[model samples]
Target: MTNSKKFALVTGSSNGIGRAIAENCAARGFNVLLVALPEPKLEEVTNALAAKYPNQEFHCLGVNLMDAGAPQEVFQWCQKNNFVVDILANNAGLGNSGDFLSKKAEFYFGQMQLNMVAMVMLTHHFLPEMQKLDKAYILNVASMASYYDIPFKGIYAASKKFVSSFSHSLRYELKDSNVFVSILCPAAVLTNPEVIKRDANMGFVSKITRQTAEQVAEYALSRMFNRKPVSIPGVFPKFYRTLGRVIPHRMQLRMLANAFIKQSRE
Candidate 1:
């Protein structure tokens, strides 16, 4: 990594929205440090991005963020390599749709570890170094589900709500600092085959609010740089979020529960 070039450390960046964010960062002149699970895909993405943006540096670290102490390990690796991370994108997360009881206890534990705990740990480990810079940014990838209590995606929604709340609080605390914190609460993103199929099966609302991974990444980075506290990528998602605010919480819960229950059965 070049000492003069800024770096964006992006988690879960081997595929999906994470990958798009890494690519977008490179396009915007930031060297990228891509973190994901140990897989050939990670190396492939690293090489591809390096070739595409020859002027920028692209590095990959494959480690499971859900494991204890993993965030510290990542920070140490960056320190060892002298990779100054100007932007921290805590984008790694896990989500599954099913009846809460249908999944094993281990599944929920791992989901929380990755979606909530890992995000917090990574931010904690990185924030001090980020604050030392003239300007830095932390982008937490939450979900539009953070705004509602849905039936089938209860755990995922709750985890994202934690992200939303944590990001807002942290951003407020750092209002006078160089560290700018933002959260991306995208609605339905068409990320992969499974996600595409799942979104196709959902209601009209999901379809209308759906965005491509690239679209979400573009919007998220723009908003993050602009210091926008919360970024919802699509027009329909913004509208839906506004509408949700006016509806009573009990009615919103019932409507979401009914819709998700029917969708799950189908």
Candidate 2:
């Protein structure tokens, strides 16, 4: 790790909440390491951010995290570039809504690989270095669905639950270290076109709980730096998660079935 300026490494930073977070970090005077798949989107975002923040250094890493070796490769790339990481944001994840049984076995496996395994691997690779620093931050992006088991989005919810649980436990484990870990569980972030349309169709719930990607990104970084264990971005999302805790499991499952199954039919 270089002794020069601090760098914040953000995964899935090509667009959406990840991109916003990266931009926020750069705006706060940290050099940004942008990681995403090898695509034009990555180049476009890196170029735009570099132009926007000409004072802060922006390094682009185009690697697919779905590949098992990608995390190590990213670590090595940073080492080679003499970029010392002061913050790590494990924000790369995917979510799908559908009957689990209807999808191929490989589809579910791939989600596990990307949504869970990749996150763990990235944290594992960067944490030791972060621990060596006087102060460092790790923000793992979970989801509001982590608090409930949704019928149609079973795997997605379960994966996020693992992330939420793992992040909290890891925070305690690293309490004595300089590394501070936090998790962000945002509800409906209007990240893509599909989500934008879905949010409009979901009636009042979406409007109440839903937040824009930029809003979530800004809120998440603030909470993470403050060392908050868990962050639910919007007021309604925080309320919804709090309410989910006391509800009976059977009732929660029933409500999810009624809501999501009805949406599927519609």
Candidate 3:
């Protein structure tokens, strides 16, 4: 018989929100399989978590999910190691900033590959099993951009929109099953890495009013376990989503273009 104890597989957990998610899972008494690219940060996080939570089982699998076969490798690793996950946190993604036409098609396409393709593949890998479980969860991280047609961040927005839509369908398709799915929509979070880097206009993203990375993860997961269809991690982002629905399409696009273009020039 499979172990019924909750196990969580957290992708991109070396740092940022992903790191917080991994730590949070461990704190919640869930055995964690931390997936990230091989690097010093990965090693540091793995070692740190192992030391901090000696009682909880922690396995760090380092692989670049950008590679086509990475998702399958994760599934195989789980099979070989005899680990079954109750939660799959798809947190790995790359941001798409700047002009759309100026970028090579491959750039936009590659962003999709990482953001959408990888997520879909990873979900397919474990979703069937999750559906069968009495209690299971899949947490997908989308962004505030997911709700609108962003100007400068066009491709990134599109990819996240895909995630949001895909997750909604998955939720409905698996409605008969016990597994719950929640897509987290968040606004600009001024994390350590993002904060120090000067945003051309915002000057270190002072406009952002939201929870920290750890707080978002904690809240999102709580709602995920409760089986919320989608969880907007902050008040501002949720308001933005609501605004997107009410605002005129052309006006919204123009506003985004003006704001981001001005920011770029600054």
Scanning candidate 3 in windows of ten residues, the lowest lDDT window is 195-204
Please, what are the lDDT tens digits per residue for candidate 1 over residues 101-179?
8889998998999999989998998898888899999999999899998888899999999999999999999999999
lDDT of each: 0.90, 0.87, 0.81
Choose the strongest candidate by lDDT.
Answer: 1
Name the runs in model 2 displaced over 4 angstroms: 1-4, 263-266
Residue 93 shift from truth in candidate 3, angstroms: 0.8
lDDT at residue 56 of model 3 (Cα atoms): 83
For residue 117, give model 2's deviation from the true position in Å: 0.6
Residue pairs of candidate 3 with colliding backbone atoms: none
Task: lDDT winner between 1 and 3, please give it.
Answer: 1
RMSD (Å) per prediction = 1.7, 1.5, 2.2
Superposed Cα deviation of residue 90, candidate 3 (Å): 0.6
Question: Tens digits of per-residue lDDT for model 3 on 180-200?
Answer: 778988666555443334233
lDDT of 2 by residue, 209-261 (tens): 88888889889899888888888998988788878989999999998887676
Write down the TM-score of every candidate. Answer: 0.95, 0.95, 0.92
Q: Residue 182: error of model 2 in Å?
A: 0.4
